[model samples]
Target chain A: MLPDSAPLSAATATSPAEEVLTVEHVSKSFGDNHVLQDFSLTLHRGENLVVLGKSGSGKSVLIKCIIGLLPVDAGRITVLGQEVGALGHDELDQLRTKVGFLFQSNALYDSMTVRENLLFPLRRHWMADRRGQEESMVMQALDDVGLVETIDKMPAELSGGQRKRIALARTLIIPPEIILYDEPTTGLDPITAREISQLIREVQQKYTTSSIIISHDMNCVRLTADRVALLVEGRCYAEGTFQELQQLDDPIVREFFV
Target chain B: MNSTILAETGAITNFAWRFFRHGFRPRYEVQELLYQCYVVGYQSLPLVGITGFIMGIVLTLQSRPTMAQFGAESWIPTMVGLTIVREMGPIITALIFAGKIGSSIGAELGSMRVTEQIDAMEVAGTNPFKYLVVTRVLATTLMLPILTLLADAIALYAAYIGINLKGVTTLALFTNNIISTLTFGDVVPAVIKTFFFGFAVGIIGCYKGYNANKGTEGVGRAANSAVVVSSLVIFLLDLLAVQITSALGLN
Candidate 1:
């Protein structure tokens, strides 16, 4: 396992040769309030790119656009080499099987048990050969998240941290090529948040999957991010390693470091 | 106010259009639909049955004194049966259903929307509209009519009990009296309109819930407005049904 405080230089020394996802000059707005304006970023295979921003700085919007949940007003989002806006419903659904998203709320179906929640995506994107292995797959995913004991429990029964872990496990069940985490450590305690940050790194190493994590949590950024992009005023204001950005003299970037 | 109403109308129309487009396609959510049917139809029987029973008994007792003045006490069975089947049973049950199922669906889906469960489903490669909205709408549409019919039967049975409480009338005679006066026009028109009522309740509940916003407060608003709008729609549809039946000479 990689050291908990491994620097970005050591962590991503051998950059994988791939551009799994890209947002090119994407702009999105709700009414007069522009949330994202010409914001662009890239995720290479096996890299954790954290988009650091204050709440409402369009961090979540950028993730949603990448996953095709929200359409961009201008520019394009291409995931796994397919233009998100150009795809049809069926095509998008197919593409989504290769991309997992973890919502800030955990968003586990309240009515379903953890097992059923994990099985939902697997069944939705079912392949005939994997029919009988669903049980094993679910167990393995739960094991990965260290929540196998909570499989039968409803989401409401779990603690906030457990719920967040379960949501991550659900995302990992399908083994998506890319994972988008929206405020994964937002509501957890410091200890749980740090644990989640470590878990994020563990998942990256295990699955070799690209990820875009949206967070303003400095500790989480230090622990999980290989590269951090600062989102400010609906734009990618600065981009660098966490330590590099921390040393920068810019006031806007320093505000976050402070 | 007018603009808000117009905007709501346009939004509902668009939502309905999406439903039609997605609802009829393949990969149907049969399991969810069945589960919803049980929740909406079977679980609601007790409330609907009690309301129907009370309605029948109250109508009989109230009409008894009036009928006695004309020495038409024996005609109570026919009048009560016709009234229950034609209007009272369907309307009262639909209103109650609006309160129960419509609000339930609205709140459930509204909570889902606010909590991002719907978005999660979409990310999971499931069409949440098909899995949640369509199943619920179909269940309400299919189940409401059945519930109304059952309520009508219970009300008629209660009317029989009410009649017996006052004077001893043979069961055969009461049945014959009511059956003889009831025509295909009376039964068919009432039954047919209930389908529309069911559709209205289902569609309106879904429309409100699916678009719910503003968090927990929005959930409450969705549930409350679903019941209110559906109840209003039930009455309006009932009025329209009456006019259509009269025009078609089925009145």
Candidate 2:
């Protein structure tokens, strides 16, 4: 067992190239709750799929099923042609290394500084050889988020928006083929939100990796998403471009967007 | 049966089985385990140690005169050792752990769940349970016994000191008295129960925190449940452990 002090560095994550993620009709429930019901969504390589929903709409649960965080009562999730829910622990981890996540609250380890956080995915022996390149990539990712100045700071030392950006940097530094963002713009001000939206688009353009963003922010949905899906009542109620979705005049879409 | 209670019980049972399975798996999440130990064990030493010392000393001091009234002061060492190692030692340490490690784990996972970070792990083709929950639970299970051992030692030492204050006795004589009264029977059961204490603390903390919902309120629920449930489980498990240990003739 590697000592607990070992860092999770970004160097260990990169995969061959672009990979598409697919989630078929997946349904999940905790007893009577029916948390996710017949949820279906498709993510293409390098495409950004934005999910917008109300507070209890199961938008997040849909993502969880796709990545096997929560098991589906039925259906399948395939990432890069491998079935996600069917895989064993090691296989699942191997798949995780290829995906990056930007937590809504910027779940940076409070114990570590920005530099240590940036090197987290790469510091372990598994990523030891790729450490230098990962470090450089992290620097570039931090630069992309306008957080290059705060490398020495702890998560508490940064502003909320800055923390979100650091989370973005953490997600991007690993240079994974898929990146998922949850509430990427929820707590930010208009200007900062715009900056984040721009950054998301920039990442899509740069990495050409598939991305799925879970958010209630309409502006974010409109700006960075190539296609939008409204996850409600345990299912993908609707899926389309923002324009297509906006034109539908569905009550759920109106409630979410307006 | 009411589903909430029934399901909770079933969930507890199911989680217990998985914990044993994944806890010993290769790639032991060594770092996460250490992080938990550091968070759950090392940092908690001072508090648990102090608690154990006072528990032993106070128990001895209070009971000494009482026992002396019955001409039974000699039971001080065995009594202190039994109280510290078997019950107070594990229970107090777990409560401290429930406060420190439990709340932290709850708050951490609760915030992650609310923020959708845990979801992101899933979309990235990661098993959030394995990465987040299993590693953490395993870490707690492994470290709690070690912490209990340390607390047990500290408490016994404090009991000796307490005994010295009120009466006259040589180190050898005091030590001999303790040694003669104490047996593997006392130590083994006391130590064995601690593992349960630790496991209960970790598992209850994880279950409450990981299953939290309702955003900000979820975080509160997680922290609150971590402490309340783990604390309750300590007593429940202590009862079960004692029953089993006595039944097995380890008493």
lDDT for position B112 in model 1? 94
Those runs of model 1 whose alpha carbons end farther than 4 Å from true positions after fitting are A1-16
**Tens digits of per-residue lDDT for model 2 on A1-258?**
122221111122333444488777778888889877666777878789887778777776776666666778898889878998789877877877787777666767676798877776554325655645866877887888887889999888998889888887877766788887878888789999988999899988988778999988888888898788777676677777787777766566677666
Encode model 2's per-residue lDDT on B1-251: one tens digit a residue. 59887898788778778777766665456676667667777787888888878877888898898889999887778777667766788778878878888888888888877766565455444455666788778678878888888888888888888888988666676667767777798878777777777777778778777788999998998989888878888888888887898798986
Measured by TM-score, how close is model 2 to the native structure? Answer: 0.76
Q: Could you tell me the lDDT of residue B29 within candidate 1? A: 84
The candidate that wins on TM-score is 1
DockQ score for model 2: 0.27
The candidate maximizing DockQ is 1
Q: Estimate each model's TM-score.
A: 0.95, 0.76
